[model samples]
Target: MLATTPKPPYYAVIFTSIRTSYDKEYIETAKKMEHLASLQEGYLGHESAREEVGITVSYWKDLESIKHWKSQSDHLLAQQKGRDKWYAAFKTRICLVERDYGFEREEQT
Candidate 1:
C-alpha cells in the first residue's frame, strides 16, 4: 500500500538494501522498527517493498526527527545487525519532498 503523507516540506528517508540471506529475525526486526517509528514525535508514514532488493521510505516532519530515529536505541541495534549479518549492501538517502501526486482507482464492488 502507498503511504498517505502530509504536504510538501516533509522529509523522506529512503533505505535501499540487498540482503545476505533469509534471516528469520529480519522480518521481526523490520516490523519492530516500523512500530517504533510510528510512535515517534514526527513520524508521518512509510511504504516498503522487497524483491531482489529491499526498499523502505519513511516520511518525517523534519531532518531532526530522522536524526532522532537513527539514534534510537533499538534502531541502533537493528542497524548494527543489518550491517553485520543481514545486509550484503545498503544505501540511505534523505530528501525533502517538494511535491508529490498519484492516483488510486476505486475498487469495483
Candidate 2:
C-alpha cells in the first residue's frame, strides 16, 4: 500500500493484500472483522474492495487508535492467518490525514 500523509489532524490506515484462492469462509471472516472494527474507538470510516488485490482503508482519529487496532487480539490473529493461509502477500501503510478537501455532490436543495 502506497500512502502519503496529507498534513495531520487525522489518520488513515491502508491495508492492501494479494489474496489466495478462497472458498465460502472468506465472507464469514470478513464480516466478523468489519463488525469488530466498528466497535473500536476513534474509528471514523472505512472503504474496501478487491479484484486481483484486496484493499481496505480505515480512518481513525489518531495514531493511538491505530496502534490499538493493530494490537487487538482478533486483528493480530487475522494477520497471522492472512500470512499463513489467506494472503499471497500484504502491506499496511499508515498516514496522518492532516487536511482534507472534498464536497458532497448531493445537496439538500
Best by TM-score: 1
Q: lDDT of candidate 2?
A: 0.80
Q: Tens-digit lDDT track for model 1 on 1-109? A: 8888988889999999999975969989999999999999899999999999999999999999999999999999999999999999999999999999889999999
Error of 2 at 1 (Å): 21
Alpha carbon lDDT at 11, candidate 1:
93
Candidate 1's displacement at residue 76, Å, is: 0.2
Considering only N, C-alpha and C atoms within 3 Å, which residue pairs clash in candidate 1? none
**lDDT (CA) per prediction:** 0.94, 0.80
Candidate 1 runs further than 4 Å off: none
In model 1, the Cα lDDT at residue 73 comes to 100
**Residue 14 lDDT (model 1):** 95
